[model samples]
Target chain A: MSSLQLPILWAMLCLYVGAFVLDVYQFFQSNEKVKKAAVIVTVLAVAVNGILVVLRGILIQGLPLNNGFEFGMCFALAIGIIYLILLKKFALSQIGAFIMPISIALSCWLLNLDMSVNPLNPSLRSYWLSFHVTAAVIAYGTFAISFGLAIAYLLREQGKLQKMPEAEVLDEVSYKMVFVGMPFLTIMLITGAVWAEYAWGTFWSWDPKETFALVTWLVYAIYLHIRLMRGWRGKKTAILSIIGFVAVIFTFFGVSYLLPGLHSYIS
Target chain B: MHKFLRSLASLKLAIYLLAAMAGLYAVAAVYGDMEIYSSWMFRLLMAVFWLNLFSCTVLHLPGAWRISRRKAKADFAGSGYENIAQAENCSQDEITAVLKKMGFKMDTAENEQGICIFAQKGKASLFAPHVLHLAILIIIIGAFLVSFAVSGAVICTDGQKVALPSAVAAKIGEGYEIVVEKFETVYDDQGAVDNWVTTLDLTKDGEVVASGQSMVNHPLIYKDLTIYQNSYKYHFLLSLEGVNAEADGVYSLPEDLAVDVSDDLTLIAHGLSDEEVFVHVRYKGEEQTYTLILGEPFAFKDGISMEYGGENNYTILQIKYAQGSKVVFLGFIIACLASVMFWSSRYREIYLRQAKDGAWQGRVYCKSPEIMRKMKEDFETNLRGK
Candidate 1:
């Protein structure tokens, strides 16, 4: 708990930098060993970050989602876990070069966070808290993955990210990421509404948080519809995916700060 | 007219409108008026979007239905299932079994060339998109019906009975009474509150129809009625007694705990506790700290004293009976299932036919060209058992 000595998050940031450097190096050169090492280091960073979160969780006797700092760390942790899962599931190439830097930036940002444990506010003391927070963090992680993959799609389509999969494969994987993430996002919204109905007397109050959440969902919903119905591919779907993640970022970060609502606890 | 209809169902127009709506949402977020969700522009865009959804789904329903019911054609002229150990010599039942495992519907019909086997997979779920859209439409309709539902809040303190008031805001009428058996507030280690919990019961016709605890994320149910612990307020009761018990008086303390019982006796609270309030009693030109048990009167001096009475804590609860919320929930479940089905990997058409050389040929097609190639690779493995 001392601010001076063991900066756990600072160490985590160093690991992030090391992983990013290795991934970028592996991307430029077709060194399988380097790729393997980068994956290992990234995994290690994630593990260390997990220790930090777990320690925080234990200190608070709850999930690390009661404040902006906690939620941000939770979101960063989600992105790391989802990234590892993607690496395991797909025969991905050096696309980690693109995603790792974002992870690094988020991890570095964690250094600035208070990281102080705050008790759950009255509004957040619900059984749905776990489900809601879990779904939201996972959804945000997948959204970040989708954004990174879309960028990879654009680059690979133009013959960049040489070792990465072709444009079509990148697009398909990104869409699949959305497929996995969208359900969790839907669950987030549903549980949020149910929780609101439980606590606020109304299910749909059109609060700023809820409204922007709907906005984000609509953006992604439109992306899904156009991709499925119109047979959209490559550039168009990739752009929409990127746009969808932007909306997600705003819903998660921007709205909390700029447009406060019944969800000020997150802010 | 053809062009107009195309425009009405236009994907380009849909995207433009959606983007415009997104812009509107940004405006709403910036201006901080969530009422924008119910604004005219929002409603208009939604109306257009709904129309687009209706036309898109209705227009596609027949095609999907037809495809679901129709025969699948696979050319045996150039390609067929040809690589299995016993594919060429395999009986129709064996082929059918493999086709079923591969998620294909098997059928055989005599043709001019020879007997043809057509297997189809995922084609029926191709219709799921339309059904998904329909479920969304149903949910919107159900949301509209929510406006007419019976909803209101009933607030009561600990061990108080609250009657379900008549609703000018609601239509449906049912007779039930609520009682707050106890209201508990839990605080964290830092003395920060965690949540307010209300132990509630519904009595109907002299029967305890339901009884349970409700908190922020939890609710109690009785028939169609839902009781939620919405909010709370703290009330402090104060009673003063003279040391001789001759100048006794009862008073309701404000939130700031300020009261002038007499010109000479001014009571101001420094802090509140369940058992007592820490107060500064300025009397006789001096100040001293005293414990004021809010409801219980204790003699402090020959002139006056005060005691803390039980708190009149009111737990606000929303008692609602939403008629179409169940339908909304059903719609949500269906939408989740249908979205999974609709956006799943494209419907596959697997064509198997017996060629002139007594060999089986197969071809696979998918709208998602990526999935087509992958499915072909997997199908090859299925055929060769490699």
Candidate 2:
């Protein structure tokens, strides 16, 4: 079963790439049919990705969020899932052009990396590993979706001042998405700290990964404060959201690669 | 004092302190000496910094200052008195529209619940920074308490009366002493240790008391203290005997001329001639042959340097003993439990309000859907069933 699932995952990866290209093409054409088709393709890709994860889990006898490669794949899959849910709820199909490419790029990056499978170490035999990493990936995925929404919000705000379609709807959608993502991010941070304590005997050792995650949390906190207390909304809020997401990106990728710590396993 | 008490309880203060602390921690991680900064001290500093920052920021002093400056300019333009007050009192939605005219996008809505606006991003996670800061403080306090006030170690050896360390012994009450009756270890064919067991008797005086066996990973607990088999070492004993072949007289015999040494001896001797004796010495299972003068003793040089290889045939005997030590295992268990709790239990609350029209309408909020879904499903099921 495991062997069979590997090929299916490869096929899913190809479909994601195809959908990403179609979405990029639609971005230039500005045709509703093309855009709708892109959305359908992305949904199909998400379904295939979901099936792949399920099959892999059944074959491995557990959730496949066990190692670094699996973690990367899971994170990409989560981004796809978040995109689908938000796209349906907000009717922000135009942003699909941006999101699909980002998901595909991340997935392709994972596909090209060294994908070695090894048995879990005795220390990782606990159930906490699954709970902690899965939560973190989902949180990251939500943040990625919010990042795309923030970009759209900024563009729509700019378009609106020029007496264009009121981008206020887009702004609201972006704000709502970020609001949803924030609590998840908080949970991720908490779970991560707890898991670290269990595995390494210290809760917050200021390991580079922990440090970056904290920074990302702080950036979002700043954004939230400005929005709620000072009545910051619109383009300025969108800009701050973009900045926070950039920090999130740095935390997720740059820290893992540039700084060697307990999380070196991700590298 | 009333003002101070109110300020102390302010959520704004908490937010400020949390942010400041987070900023300081980031700086400390980058530049400050981690070795000099205790975890507890860092946590405390962080908590204070964030609380103050959040309080100051939330008070909107900076925004008020900007608004006051703008009002001064508007007054200088000779606007009517009532109009100035009205301008100052502009509803949040009108202010949002003005902001939108300035190329800003602000989303505002008014309901009976009062007017509210959400900025384009990160407004929802605004509370996370403070929550994380508080959580970190708790974790640090828990860790500090466990490491300092509640942790101790105990050591025991086989067939020996072992006293607890002075620090721990003082707290262990009055009527208990630990005696290890026998400690043994089993090894595989490849010489790797398979398991170790320590049979211990807890005695008040010298009577046969409460007894238990402790092995690797599985420790024996008595009261608050636990005993674990930590390690073992080998001890050997050797014996040597001597015979005077030259002191013959009437009792002289050929067999009595050379002494017989037991296998326990470090050195063995045989009189090959009147002037010399041949000696066979063993140390750590390796044998060395030596010739000794009639009255002179042979020296064996090693970790244990010996002066005599006996004259006449001698016997050497070797005996081996295994010594084992056990330590209190509670510390390990506590550390594991603390880790599990810290990682798994993240506090999150989801508020869902259904519309009066009997349709499913609500907000889903949580850190991970994996955790949130179970709750969401339960709530949904219960609500639908009703």
Candidate 3:
């Protein structure tokens, strides 16, 4: 590795870690001013993270999505942006405290991988790949927020947390997040299928990545479907939302490495 | 009709179908090679889901459209919602102005008791759910059509002239042929391949009609067909010494491709490994394998010596006539647009009426009570100077 590359990559890691520390401190600090400071610091870290992802993209000549660490950063940036959007709807500084640790852990693990830029694989060469990854990022981002909100809903329902949005409000907002994000997931599947048809000679390859993606979609589809029923509110909806996000996590992180396929390039 | 519609349009049925799909997909993912979607059970499930969606749309869309199209009501008498709020001593016009500020379309009706004002916001949101289902139906239909569409793959070596296997070569009796004039691999400065391009020529009725280059993303469009440069294969060429002999001429061979050594004998190159090259030879329905080192000649039954000269690459092209793909794209575009429109907004209604004490009361019904509260505060701050 070059002398400058480590520092440049570590700069993003430091900022994420710094924001995570401040968020943890805010959990114990009841002072609203300190809470606001934590939010501000988290926002700064997310900004720096954004720059890191964009700068890596510029360095790599495409989106920072060709490798594991770069994709984690890209996904982290999406989650960061989605968290910020949710801050408008909920008092979610605490939620950020819950979410940033995951961000740091993933970025840390991926950053420890081979950080050098490499030539893009021939199979990864396609306009549909760009669309597929971009949509996957956005969809996973919203799913991330829905995850946080679902947890918040559960905790508040059990009276285990305080000063967040009401459990009902959190449940509804989480549903809304999924409702808004499901189309992106749909687009991701469609574009990936189309790309597979171009590259692999079939639209659905029954590959692990494609299958898990469909599994994730089915989970969210079930989440939305059961939401229409009168009795399936509160804990049922919250638990289902969490399950859906778990499927999202499995689809995004697990499938690439644990179940290798044509999409192993992303990992 | 009522009983049948009720049974067909059940949300429980939809949820059950979705759950079944989820189960099928889980099984497929765990099993790893079985395609869940192509199975008859999954297709049956999907067909039933389609019926549910269609029936749901048919049963509910007109009512949704009517709810979206109706004028906002100021009186709770029409809808039977209890008064969630009361702006006592506020004029009907003042209340209408407040609801308008809250993004409601305002209307008022003069009842026997007093003037009642009603306002609505996000009437367009009522159409979103129905539109989403309809778009999904269209997309599924399009995908179904495209799945069964006629498509074929054609493999051609470099400098070979071949007709597209799938696309009809003769359009109204005019014959056409594609000549892959050259297939070149472009490499970046690092020596990694950047992209491969295939130069193509389309001749129809003894005249050159269309010709261009095609790559992965850039496909060649000729008439009703799109020819994609899908993949490439490498073949090691064997040079012959004699001009009129099959073994004395140049022939390209890969493990999968066979070359005629004579009329009855064939030579197929297996691969080169461990300083040894392998080629499979077959004559008169008898298969035999021979090993030859690099720069060595192999003697066959007819006394023909075969030499591994060099290698050549061939491009694989897939010719497709996707008549229903455009419909799929259209469905995708519609689904995306309608989903964004549907989820981004919400429907809200406000009703204002006079109570028995000669005081006006208004109620707000919305998915968001916070927005309603903010609007109420704004109205109070505007009117009562709070």
True-vs-predicted CA distance for residue B95, candidate 1, Å: 3.0
Q: Alpha-carbon error at B369 in model 2, in Å?
A: 26
Choose the strongest candidate by TM-score: 1
Which is the leading candidate under lDDT?
1
Candidate lDDT values, in order = 0.74, 0.54, 0.73
Q: What would the per-residue lDDT of candidate 3 be over residues B1-386, giving only the tens digit for each residue?
A: 87798798898888888788777776777667465567788788878988899999899999988877666443545654444344566666666666666566877667565677667778767877787788878877877876765556777766888875634443223366678888877777777777778898877665778899877766777654677778888676765553344346777776567877766677788655534557787876889887767677766655566676544668888777655566666776776676676665578776667744566666667655666676656655665631
- Model 2 lDDT per residue over A228-263, tens place: 556678888788778777877766677677766777
Best of the two (2, 3) by DockQ: 3
**All candidates: DockQ:** 0.52, 0.09, 0.38
What TM-score against the true chain A does chain A of each candidate get?
0.93, 0.88, 0.91
**Candidate 3 C-alpha error for residue B311, in Å:** 8.6
lDDT of 3: 0.73
DockQ leader? 1
lDDT of 1 at A124: 76
On TM-score, who's better, 2 or 3? 3
Candidate 2 lDDT (Cα, 0 to 1) = 0.54
Q: Report the lDDT tens digits of candidate 3 across residue range A1-267.
A: 234446655776776777777766765775787777767776777887787776777777777766677777778888888887777656666676667766777677766778777887666777787788888888888888788778878888888767655777788778878887887898888888777756654566578778888888888888877775444678888888888888887776788767777777766
> Each model's RMSD to truth, in Å?
4.0, 16.3, 6.7
Model 3 chain A weakest lDDT span, ten residues long: A1-10
Residues B139-159, model 2: lDDT tens digits: 444555444422234444446
